[model samples]
Target chain A: MPSAEEAADAVDVTALLERGRTLATPVLKKAVDRLAPPMNTVAAYHFGWIDAAGNPADGDGGKAVRPALAVLSAQAAGAAPEVGVPGAVAVELVHNFSLLHDDLMDGDEQRRHRDTVWKVHGPAQAILVGDALFALGNEVLLEIASVDAGRATRRLTTATRALIDGQAQDISYEHRERVSVEECLEMEGNKTGALLACASSIGAVLGGADDVTADALEKYGYHLGLAFQAVDDLLGIWGDPESTGKQTWSDLRQRKKSLPVVAALAAGGPASERLGELLAADAKNNDFDNFSEAEFAARAALIEEAGGRQWTADEARRQHKIALEALDTVQMPATVRAQFAALADFVVVRKR
Target chain B: MPSAEEAADAVDVTALLERGRTLATPVLKKAVDRLAPPMNTVAAYHFGWIDAAGNPADGDGGKAVRPALAVLSAQAAGAAPEVGVPGAVAVELVHNFSLLHDDLMDGDEQRRHRDTVWKVHGPAQAILVGDALFALGNEVLLEIASVDAGRATRRLTTATRALIDGQAQDISYEHRERVSVEECLEMEGNKTGALLACASSIGAVLGGADDVTADALEKYGYHLGLAFQAVDDLLGIWGDPESTGKQTWSDLRQRKKSLPVVAALAAGGPASERLGELLAADAKNNDFDNFSEAEFAARAALIEEAGGRQWTADEARRQHKIALEALDTVQMPATVRAQFAALADFVVVRKR
Candidate 1:
């Protein structure tokens, strides 16, 4: 295993994430196989290996970060790496389940450089994809338990319900305006937070981490998720379009109710006024559309001056500190501990 | 519990169906809690208790026949009635999940005496309903297993995967025109048969019935589902609209290639000719509005005369015979055994 210094140098978790993706693809493919026609095509499209008409395509599947975290957590907790394979599959499947639905809700037409499932196959097929994904996750979890019948069943169930509960809160936030910063934190804590927690905590449950350690890892995951989101929110607008493969200031264009925007909204001064103007311009496609490079630069400046950027960075740093503290709870060797702690900075400090 | 002779008096299963519905309402309401907003509202409307506005409304939900059968299978498996509540909830949730997506596939506007979830909530929210439902079913299954920690864990994953496989086939069926009889049977086996088998099998796994008995119950469910489909095929064209609450000869109007129709197509006889004519008629109705009552009646007569009705009935009877064989595989009190045997007959004989 890489030490903390090595992990920091590795800056790329690509190989680990790739291994995780490889582990999950077959289990998910089996699920899609049991469901797709001619025993193949649709599953392939979901994995971005084929188009809707069943033609093969070499497409980027995803970073598959969750599955990697799950596998690593299991390995860290003393499970054989193979034991983590099913857990890795379970985490990836659940993550995709949410994405299938999230794309539909947010009206995202593309994901990972391909048409979203709903866009490609229409809503009906998309719904089925999400259904199959969620079912597959549970099936994988049970498969793990089948291998170790003495495992704590309650923990898996509780983790799943927590993930679902977090999804509920995330959806609820869409309807709610004027949410407090604390409430937003709480919402994200459950939605994105619980699942990450589960990725680690399920490892604990399987590897028999004491409740204290499991609870600490759950908090580790939660704080890490918040830090991750804080950085993501900053990148959503200022991110390099080429690097992110998305429109710059994309979240602003969509009027997304993210942390930076919420913080700006609550700050409620020139920042709020400028944010509202940008949103209205977006809604009307007036000055927002067909902008000159200078106009776009000016708009970006207004956004930053509004304190949205600073608030987000501050929050990310704060959460990273919390996440590092939680990492200390794990009984891994000093070298592995350093590697895990570096992950906290990697998440919050990412430029893209 | 009702006796065989007593239930044989052409009694209404309405009360039994209602009991399942009543039990599910609170369970679903709590499961689709505040976190899932439009999803909760969408699921609520699908259950027929809420309007498009999320306000309460008076209307019928589904007949709850699936869940009723689940409970009955558990009882027939000789478990305490209460143990089946989670199974009932799981089955109903899965059924509704299928319906939510099916409505999207068929562009069905109304369901359960109300607008379909997609009709009012858009396909996105409907997708969430289906996703949440599958998740909820797994959640319920895990909870059920928690109570029985050691038992049912191994097979629960298997049973749930079977359902996923079934639904996947059903999804892929929409695009394919060349489903073989055996393939179609396998699909139906997964769709209708698997869940029914799970109902009783889970019961046995939970607390009652030995391995041989569970196998018997599962086989009984398999044939019963085939018989039920046969009856549905019969009703598709010949059913009384008042009783079935479906348009008269609607399946013919839609040119549905049902089991009997598929059988006829394979045979290439008079039934095939009639089926072709019906398909032509459906092709002519660009808006599903060109069918005159007289022409509909003529087509219905053709379907009846060309052995469609008789063939369906024969298939139903043959399947019932198979189901009877399965029932005989288990030992029960003569009176109790007669109960399940009669219910098997009821699958084909009941109207609506």
Candidate 2:
């Protein structure tokens, strides 16, 4: 395997993501266009292909990380990048499906600095459009009419179930006063890890790679997902508002039981005790309306003082190292391995 | 083909439906059981397997008509009934997924003499559970790991898209002041017909039936779905409330654009004109809250007087006949054909 410095120098992360998006977008658009009227419009808008009024607009359509993983995984399995387009499209669709529903459930108004589908079209359209995209994802795979497609679909659906299970857990945890770090990790694994794992390996599965190689790639993606989510949780509290497109102490404002909060609570220091009391006070009141900016800043400070921030940063590095190690178990071209490593590095350190 | 009299005499519709439920219930339960905690609880409750608090209870989980079609289609394809269990479970899951989402979209509080998933649990859980079920449906098919399973999953996803399209049309139609009879039929054909078509042919596809026979079976089920929906629309307006487990003039109460209402509006007579004026009044007011039972009864009388009742009844019969004729195009055992014919007849004549 290439050393970390070599891997970073060998690949341009921005160009790789752009290439993956370029390869997958046409197929994704074609699949989505099959949807009937209002749903088609809603989906197009959510994908940032158009504005709310149905006019053409260039908007942010995520970072295309999942699609890049899919295309790279296929290449690692010794196939042309084109062989992974269906997997890339399917993964992107499923990821957006979760986003549409999660936005509604979380009651988030804006995503990527635009109104969410539920905010613009109401909840019904959001649910229906999300459902259509999921069905479209499965259809794209099965239309390949190969047994590999069937196996890939099984993998996709299994990951989808895990993703849903994670969402369910996330919601339930919001209502509870106590959540262990272990429980939080499990939830993140299901919610984030499973789908990323599928995205990473599904292309290889579709490329008819043996189970061992596909599994190794899946492990790589799964650990990468945990690392990515850890970075996300950290940013949710400490990110610059301009870069994250959210308010300061965003996770605290939402009373989200994110990794940093759970980790601090588990640390059992004086700062952790005070953090727990403050959060419990917020929970008891059942609203954050009266919370001052200083109050949120204080909570963030307490979490960091309790060593939550350092632990999480360490955890991210640990998971990233493990993810790269997984890739070493499978034989692939050095360039492909370097690309995967570069992507993992990008995920662990992304600002958004 | 046997005469209608002979077909009806040969098979007991109640026994057939019961047998289908018996065959499919275990696999369906197993699939639902795979869902994580609260979703599993919510799905169990939605399926009438348990009460609100999660204790075991025998509630009404639909009539199992789709499952019966699936199993019978497999039998007609010259396979043992057991071969169709996966298709039956998958179709049933998709059916209930739509129901859970539709009840939320339509603002329905009760179904099958009980509170809906959204009503008891909440809209978010309803959406999540419904999505979980949809994923489970695809998983059931693809886990079979054969090309035929892949084909069946493709057919299932396609039908699901059509069903969603129909729902989009249905929701859109509710807001408009005018809807033509042709448009209404097309909507119902998509909303109801497509899923039934998949249910009928998916088993045959799984059983490796030739496309011709599978297509014939699909045609039969599509017509049967229309016939079934016509009968439902009729019962929604005119059947005894006790028999239907609903209030009088249920469709009128919800302002649903059912077949009868659309047909009545298209009759172009004085009674049709009166019906239009009355409905337009309700639409203009944007609330049925002030409308009395007597007013709803009068609208029902106007619809019947406008020849809507006769046209709908005749349409159901015509569709039923076409369904029977489609069966004639396929070469199957006499008993299998008879069972299909019997099921169609029962659908047209059912009270609920």
Candidate 3:
């Protein structure tokens, strides 16, 4: 639990994110609009700015966390948030691009309380639109005209490649019965940590921060990303469907080899053995269709008994602390440091 | 139809292309090897450098025409072909990326007489590998360490966006009944012309040629691309399967909106009306599986009678002439000019 001061800081960070979204969204919308039609329409719908019929509609998009980190990092580097808008846009575009492709690859039908892009527009269009957005992100980064634009482009592309590598590994892991905790951590680092690290460092690079400062921020972002994923893995098992906007026990239902499951399997306890047996039986008999609520409840109990839930929760807190320590290496305004710390706390502690 | 002098020029040009393939393939292989497996494996297979079992196998790839153009353009601008190695690698990567995705999008099982990447690997792997190659292209460009590197990156990204736009339009056109000749030409320009134009101009830019010279080469490549497509369209309907490596009348079988088919439909002759009726009936009844050989021959004959075949052939020659004219605008060495002109002729007059 956060202290009173930290709670107030979280509220302040939330407002900062809200402002970041309001300011960055128009820039993002304009960038996406530059895509040729049908693509533009598809992108707009994916961003929740419009409906499938191309009419304006109110839809829930996430808290724009990555973009907020970009802006805050820029501010920490002694530049205004506006100076980081392009970085924000680029990161947001890439984030969406990954989401679009991952949904298709995972056969996910819904996202953010709405149908996925592949579900709504078909897989081919979704794939193409994702490609377009990836290109657009690079395009936007190059258009920044800063001395660091090339550097940023290279950084973003490298991170993107890492992200793809992670996704590919994730897909391959699904077919395997057991994945080590170390391998799971590395995958999460690549899958989720890479982009967040990019987001955290890109603004400082763009703001002309020195290499040391940039490196510190990158370290901060890297740990933050790990913590973020650890928390996300926890939520996948225990999160409220109303809050997560996903089906209950979504990760387990899909047999995802996420952090918690991998950790439990690596634990080698009786609960781990029993959970593995259940999964094997489920796979052999193709029995998920007849799986009962009681069975899901039992699985959850087994995971907790194996210390999967506590392991991930503790890991999240540990990583969060490391993230803050990394941030301490960078010299920034006190207010900016406070906000960054608050954001880190909010990331781990948020229910959704 | 070429004179004796021109025939000699064609042989020299063919040697140049062969030399380019030898030089560029190693560089391309190195770049692709940088991709993590199975992406690396998939890309290597797509390049015909290996087989599905990851063993060396002899597989026929095309003539490496685009990379040849890049090197030759650099030479035309008074730079050694080595100066344009990065350009060659970038263009070839982008070209292969498009081919991988296009094969999947078109449901093409074979390319260059072998199973396509998507057919051999799955669609998911194909899409990801295509994406990795696209990013790799940009990454390779940025590694050039010259002022031109940023400009080259921008040019490549712009052309890639246009290429995607063209593909989206092509997919949509497949569902349409009638499309105008002008629209078809515009689509072709975006689809085929854009990347070829980039390939032609990028080397000159990298070689530090003036903008005027670069623009002329760009025009040269644009026309050459159009002529190449015209020839390809003709071959799709009439070429022998032994040479084309595709089933005879394959485009007609797939109901592709090739240049000749669009022209034949737009001629508004009796043959055009009958051809349209046949297509409409085929689409409405979904009776392509039962389409007879005689009906296929009749469709080809009707397209010829409607002057579609002649019109496209004439257009190919016209574009070839224009391509040569554009080459004439550049004050290249006589030998380089001869080679460029020979390449243009080779594009239009090749039977397969």
Candidate 1 chain B least-lDDT 10 residues: B147-156
Model 2: per-residue Cα lDDT over B1-352, one tens digit each? 6675686678999998998899999999999999998999999999999999989999987778999999988998899888888999999999899999999999988898889999999998999999999999998998898888888899899889889999999999999998898898889999999999998888888899988998899999999999999998999999898788887899999898898999999999999999999899898785577788898999999999999998999999998999888988998888888888888888987888
- Tens digits of per-residue lDDT, candidate 3, B258-331, equal 98899999999699999999888877766787788888889899999999999999999988888888987898
lDDT of each: 0.66, 0.91, 0.85
Q: How many clashes in each structure?
A: 4, 0, 0
**Worst 10-residue lDDT window, candidate 2 chain A:** A1-10
Indicate which candidate wins on lDDT. 2
Candidate 1 predicts chain B with a TM-score of 0.83
Q: What tens digits encode model 1's per-residue C-alpha lDDT throughout A144-171?
A: 5453322434454455555555555666
The best candidate in terms of TM-score: 2
How many residue pairs clash in model 2? 0
Error of 3 at A61 (Å): 1.7
Clashing pairs in 3: none
* 2 versus 3: better TM-score goes to: 2
DockQ of 3: 0.58
Query: Could you report the DockQ of all the candidates, in the order they appear?
Result: 0.41, 0.87, 0.58
